[model samples]
Target: MATSVKNNSLPPSLISNLNQVLLSRQQHTIDHQSTNSSSLPSHSRNVDEPDCSKPLLLITNCEGIDSPGLIFLVQALLSDARFTLHVCAPQSDKSVAGHSLTVQETVAVCLVEMSSATAFEVSGTPVDCVSLALSGALFSWSKPVLVISGINRGSSCGRNMFYSGAVAAAREALICGVPSLCLSFDWKKDVSSESDLKNAADLCLPLISAAVRDIERGKFPESCLLNIEIPSSPLANKGFKLTRQSLWRSPLSWKAVSANRHPAAGQYLSNQQSLGIKLAQLSRDASAAGAARRLNSHRKNVEIESVGIAGKFNGQQTAKKYFRLELLEETEKADDNLDFKAVEDGYVAVTPLSLSSTDQSKIETEVSSWISAALGREQRN
Candidate 1:
């Protein structure tokens, strides 16, 4: 059996150490931001410009185009002159949409006013946004140097990654043969502020720059995308630690409700009524023409009968069933080196992900060396 730990179960000494780190870095960050403000431009160059010198970077998020997380990340990257940026994201939140694409319907894309970077808001999931952008359908370039999905509002650790639109967006890019990164914040309700998001974006700048440089030299790790999770208190985080995906997950529970109490029931009822009204009008037209009147009346009668059946079905107390999903707390033992544990301990966790099963040892070694060099730190054993 695996041991379970709660978020509030941290040792006092560890909490003290994190607080000290935060205090020490606060002044330094302020000074750094001030210095960069004078040299860096407020906005990035337009993506339409034929700037071959700077690598083109494509960014998207599950939180939609106008989210503060995405905005902060764009601001951070714009301040750096190394990459030309483009923004393509969902028009509305699709946080739990997974890797689903809008195959059944036509997806709409609209130009968005983002500072300097060319941007579009798509009427679809994060996967749809990236796929459309990279399909040579939306942008002039088919392949950007790198694709970044997120600065997401919530963590994508453990099994949650499978349900994350942000992670799916990055995975979509990897499928298209481009290196990608998925960034997320371990957001805590009420405890976390918007400034933490900006801090997280700023903190990830060095790692992003390093990844881009390695990518340009064809030295990025093969067959994997990076998923980075920033701790709740971004400024208080212990430095980045490379970690493996954990088995931790919040279990889901379904609560039963009456058909009439279900949210979708009202929409269904409204649509049925509208359909009946349309058919009734058609029946009236047929009667006026004195042709196909019987056929129209029969159709109208069927519609009315269907509506009556629906009403009776909803009125039943025990015949029909409905449910709503709710997440339940569950504990699973996670190792110190796992992504979930690292974030829980106030460290920024970076996990490398591949589409199919691969040699875990080999990938770990490669990622360890790559990130160590990227951050100018000694490699872990």
Candidate 2:
């Protein structure tokens, strides 16, 4: 179920506290003494130490202002006031641009000035933002921790997975050796609303925090990426589950119709080989005028003509347009396979992906074999 905020607003008391935290953080940024500050989270201290303490989470959204899901998720993260949250998201939604960056353009990075968090907006791709955040110039950290790509307005799963900015950002983090989470929900282009987004985030945030905690504890395997897809219904789902990506084929096609535009061309091309036989039959069975009439009848039967000059002018350019967006497929695949039958039924899908340069074949071999077991099996088999 959605966690409803009592006032649905920040408490007046927290404002002063938040400012103090922000001020202190700004000073830390200026002084650069975070290297010696044990008080800060271990992860935020410096990069030399492999065991990071502070969870420096980089949260981003692909869909800018348009996504209520993205907005509410950011709000929820800010409300938590736990991790050192740094955001560098697009000023507007750039959902399925993959990992492409806005290199040539002058991208802006402005402070979001939230009540309880250090969030910022960037005019670059999600991956670019993550890169900037992890590097010492943007936000200094000892060792990078969690990088969350989205509380995206759409989904990222299945065959379209290759084109998801949310997943791509998370993958970019993994490539840089940071634990990451990419979150999304089932959203129809026309049916979804903001309230639904809050509901989904309510379920997703806690689960994501727990995953981050586990990663911090060194529980997860190396280079693992968590792809979370929340269902539209929040009531019925219990929580997290391990699942694989899926593919789907939507049933839709388009046809173009044009009048006086040689509609018979298609039919003639299709039946070209049989036309000679058809003409021979017509010639043997009828007089020249009769055959001409028969031929016109056959042509009319085979072709659909433009009604008139106006119809000919009214040609429709039609083609089946496929939306190969990764987010959309992710949302739909999660909704269909995750069993969102109950009122708030959504499941957190944990999919482990690799971004490491190590050979995956060696990794798979290690996973499948143990020295003792392999030797024993060899002797037995």
What TM value does model 1 have?
A: 0.73
- Candidate 2 regions exceeding 4 Å error are 1-54, 249-346, 356-381
What is the C-alpha lDDT profile of model 1 across 45-98, one tens digit per residue? 334453678889999999999999999999999887678888999999999999
Q: Per-model C-alpha lDDT, please?
A: 0.85, 0.61
Weakest 10 consecutive residues, lDDT, candidate 2? 319-328
Per-residue lDDT tens digits of candidate 2, residues 1-381?
Answer: 889766667777898899999999999886786555756644333323332335766677677633566667778876776665556677776777787867767878776654344666777887777777776666655445677777786556554456778888888788778877788776667777778778877776665566556567765445457676766655556555555455542322343344224455445445664877878986997898998888788765553333222323223322222222221122232443332221124555544456653665554343223222333333464
- The model with the greatest TM-score is 1
Segments of candidate 1 deviating more than 4 angstroms: 1-47, 258-263, 266-320, 329-331, 377-381
Candidate 1 lDDT at 135 equals 90
- Candidate 2 whole-model C-alpha lDDT, 0 to 1: 0.61
